[model samples]
Target: MLKGKRILVAGAGGLLGCKLCADVLSAGALVVAADINLAAMDERLQQHGIASDDARVARVSLDLSDSSSVEQFFCSLTDLDGAVNCTYPRNKRYGAKFQDVTLADFNENVSLHLGSSFLFMQQCAKYFISNQRPFSLVNISSIYGVVAPKFEIYENTPMTMPVEYAAIKSALLHLSKYVASFMSDSRFRSNCVSPGGIKDGQPEEFLQNYRSYCLGKGMLDISDVVGSIIFLLSDHARYINGQNIVIDDGFIL
Candidate 1:
């Protein structure tokens, strides 16, 4: 469905990013995989058995936190049809009270999730407006953005969940909506995908616990997010704009 399209995927080194890249390539789209860790991405590509000779894939080193880096990356693109913002902070600690969260943690999360996305969206919108080309953006958000997760999980782990992560994600959602409204006159669409706890490479016990808590909540592989992403990027979602699609196997219900 994405034939002839050029798509840029942020966070291409991570688990979900890898799966999304493969899916977009399989759909006949040209992909530019951008990540901060180029070596990690190369290793992942090799592990996944995707050949370097594949014409559909390209890799670029991108540091989203740096404005200059973000500008340089987007400036190098000649034609961009769509972008997927899957970039996230490296930590996965999911339990902490808001009062216990540090200022550094809050700033870091905002920089990675909200600030970087805002810069990219601004640049892309400018490109679309100036070039008069239609484009789409798919921002990846967490279910925690909509509703808080159980804090009990953090009690056993070394990681501490900060309320800032959730706050930044919610901010990203609003950012998407604001961008969508700003581009309402143009052929640009911005939306969000909020997925429930994805079970990519998680331990059996953790998965089991999550599954038990979220009974009837179908476990989603990274591949499950690809279809929704593809739909959002394609002309098929031409009329869909400023909407947040939650993919959590009905867990939110």
Candidate 2:
């Protein structure tokens, strides 16, 4: 679907990010794997059998939190067709429970994740406007952003869906819409993909609880979420803008 495209996969060191690079590469796009840790991102890509010197892969370091870094990276680009932001930025105390979360930590986490998202989205739009080229940007949100958390599912688990995450992701959906509208050109579009809980070694009890709310697939794998992203980035979705595609196996239903 993305043949001949040059796509940027931010946060390429992450599990989802790395897998996304491989998937898009298989679809024939030149994958620019970016992360704050260049070495780590390269290592992760290698784990997925993407050679460091792969002809279709280019690895770069990106720290979304730094304005200069983001600007420099985007300015350095010449023909970026699309980008998927899979970066999940957080401080050390990011996942604390609601009650345990201090106001300081809350602000910091929000600034780290949401602020960086704003920066990246703004840069993408600016790049398109300046170059007058067609561009697609896919921001990764979450099912929790669409609906309230199923607190029951996380009961026995040590996870409580961090309050910061809820705030950041929910805001991101609206942010994408805002950018899409602000851009106002069909060729320059922004969209979002909100995936349900992705399996990442959570306890079975929690998985069972999660499954009860889903339609068969208890939790998604990284692969399950990439197709929608690839579609949004492809010309197949040329007219699709400011839309949110939920891939949660009916979890929010």
Candidate 3:
């Protein structure tokens, strides 16, 4: 239960990010939803039926790749108790072998998945350290970062298998650990959540294949991952830090 806490969620327009924001708000937390596309955020908020006067929810237009913008955003916040890094690049039209991966594709994924997360965490850490406040950061990663899938799931969809995504996610986990270690004496904490395959209107054939494969292995939906995030961000996980919790229904097993 995060009541009266100030929480910032980057990439708040995405499916998971939207769910997280709504849940956090329902839990009585003040949420700052930051996204590159304000229109998308507006649409999402409207769909959620959140009114303009809802002081508990604020939509901010943020370009995470821009360092000055990120700094300004964080500086504007009065009390940042927690942050969730869920920003991801458009995964459409970009699946290929490592050798076939283009520089642009690689850079785009890296900038969003890795660069943005690093910048946000760095800013949050500085603020928390200087203000002597106990804060937590939950970074969203993928199960693929830990275990390579036999088949490329993002191929047919706008999503793709890029070396940069995997590399950056792996790096994010380590970065969380490093931040945790550096602030071991402080109240600042950082951790990662690696979710498994998320089903969201994929082709029926593809969905069947994915479900069968994952069933043979083990996979779960987006809801399965929310609990871990809630725990990591809540006071319940105050002592937990520098850890990567995988919630993939034993797919990695």
For residue 53, what is the lDDT in candidate 2? 83
Top lDDT: which candidate number?
2
* Residue pairs with backbone overlap in model 2: none
lDDT, residue 216, model 1: 73
Tens digits of per-residue lDDT for model 1, 198-221: 775655655565566564755687
RMSD of each: 2.5, 0.7, 2.6
lDDT of 2 by residue, 23-134 (tens): 9999989988889999988888999989988989888889999999899999999889999999999998889889999999999999999999999999999999889989
Q: Stretches of candidate 2 above 4 Å error?
A: none
Model 1 steric clash pairs: 95-161
For model 2, state the Cα shift of residue 40 in Å: 1.3
The 10-residue segment with the lowest total lDDT in model 2 = 152-161
TM-score of each: 0.90, 0.99, 0.89
The runs of at least 3 residues in candidate 1 whose Cα sits more than 4 Å from the true structure, single-residue gaps closed, are 90-99, 152-160, 201-205, 213-218
Cα miss at 12, model 3 (Å)? 0.8
* Candidate-wise lDDT, in order: 0.80, 0.93, 0.79
